[model samples]
Target: MQVDSKAIDKFLVELLTEVGTRLREDSIKKMSVATKKNRNDLVTNFDKKTEQFINGEIKQAYPDATIVSEEGYGDLVKDMSGLVFFVDPIDGTMNFVKRGDNFASMIAAYIDGEPLNGAIIDVMDNEIYHGGKEIGLFINDRKIDNPKNLPLVEGLVDVSAPMALANKFAVQDVIKKSSGFRVYGSAGIIFGHLLTGKEVMYMSYLAPWDLAAGRVMCEAAGMSVVSIDDAPINMLESQVVIVGTQKVVSEALKTLKTR
Candidate 1:
């Protein structure tokens, strides 16, 4: 089935905006939280509710779309075959529960294993970063400038906290080579920075929902999206995501090789 990019973009914006509004409203109230895989990995009432709302809306809007979501509110997708929607209702659940500012709501629509539309809403910041292969990258109404091809040493880089702490995949060495390092808990926010060239590179182990939206946005904006080892990213599985300008990617690969 051919996708109407315009309609999908509009629907994405509306869906994300609604989710963001509810997130803001919920932030002021107390939340019910529980541990997922570990104590650090959390799930809140907001996350579950937001996901259920988004999934329900998607089903109503596009009945045939398969939704792959966090919190298990979506389908048991076995392959990236049809129209698949990857959703993370709250990208930074920890931040949403503890700080309520850095979290984001993200969704990406893919057709036949290729990303067609993507949107990430920084709920508290009132920023909506969205775009795809057909529609160009945009922050709300404005189309964003393509990120510069800056090398690692010349620009700031963002890494996952665990990767930085353990120095996994030579992450620490890459940071030392870069101008500096930043650790944002949300991959969506980190990808937002990369989309606008605020940071030269972002490296982390990410799930499908975590990377799906950002991958589309980054690729649409002429940035690189690949594994830390410079391999093709598997959209349906967790992997080490390395996204940035070409130069930054090259520098990062060099640093990783040296370690």
Candidate 2:
């Protein structure tokens, strides 16, 4: 189905808003938290419930679409063919478990690897960034303009804390070239900032669920989202990616030390 139209946008916004409501209410309740991948990688009861909720909703609405999701409640699809959905129930789980804030819920649809529409909810703020290359982007209902093509020196960059500290990919070099550096711990929030010109560039290792919705919104806003190693982005794999203005992306690619 064509998802960039007003009707489709409304459907998506309502869906995301419902998810946001659940999150807002769950934030106050005591959550069951657990570790995933490592001690620091946390997942909570709300995360699983939210993912199950989203997956069920998607199945009911678009039964044929294959879902790739952060939580395990999705299909184990190996390819991005036909209609596909990528979902991150809670984009910043650590922050959600710790601060009860600075997190988001993201969902995006793609048709044979090309973005159809993406929806990202800044849950606490009640703002949803939703749209695509054809329809542009909307913060709730406000249509936003493209960001400036800022030079690396004129803007601040957001990098993962570990990458910055370890100087992985020569990230610290790129950080020193920019106005400064930041770490938001959530790709969805960082992508929102990029669209609003709050930050210039964001670099992090991201899974498909983490990158999908943000990629759609960023590209719609005329910002560049590219792989740090100068490879074509594969939606089925995890990789270090960069999203920013064209100028900043170019500088970051040049500064990136890849063997």
lDDT values for all models: 0.87, 0.87
Which ranges of candidate 2 are over 4 A from the true structure? 1-6, 31-43
How well does model 2 score by local distance difference test? 0.87
TM-score per candidate = 0.93, 0.93
Q: Model 1 compared with the native: what TM-score?
A: 0.93
Clashing pairs in 2: none
Off by over 4 Å in 1: 31-43, 257-259
Candidate 1's error at 155, in angstroms? 1.0
Worst 10 residues of 1 by lDDT: 33-42
Residue-level lDDT of model 1, residues 110-229, one tens digit each, is: 999987999999999989999897988899989888888888888999988988898887678889988998888899898889988889998888999999999988888888888876
lDDT of 2 at 108: 91
Q: Candidate 1, 185: how far from true, in Å?
A: 1.1
lDDT of 2 by residue, 170-193 (tens): 889899999998888989988889
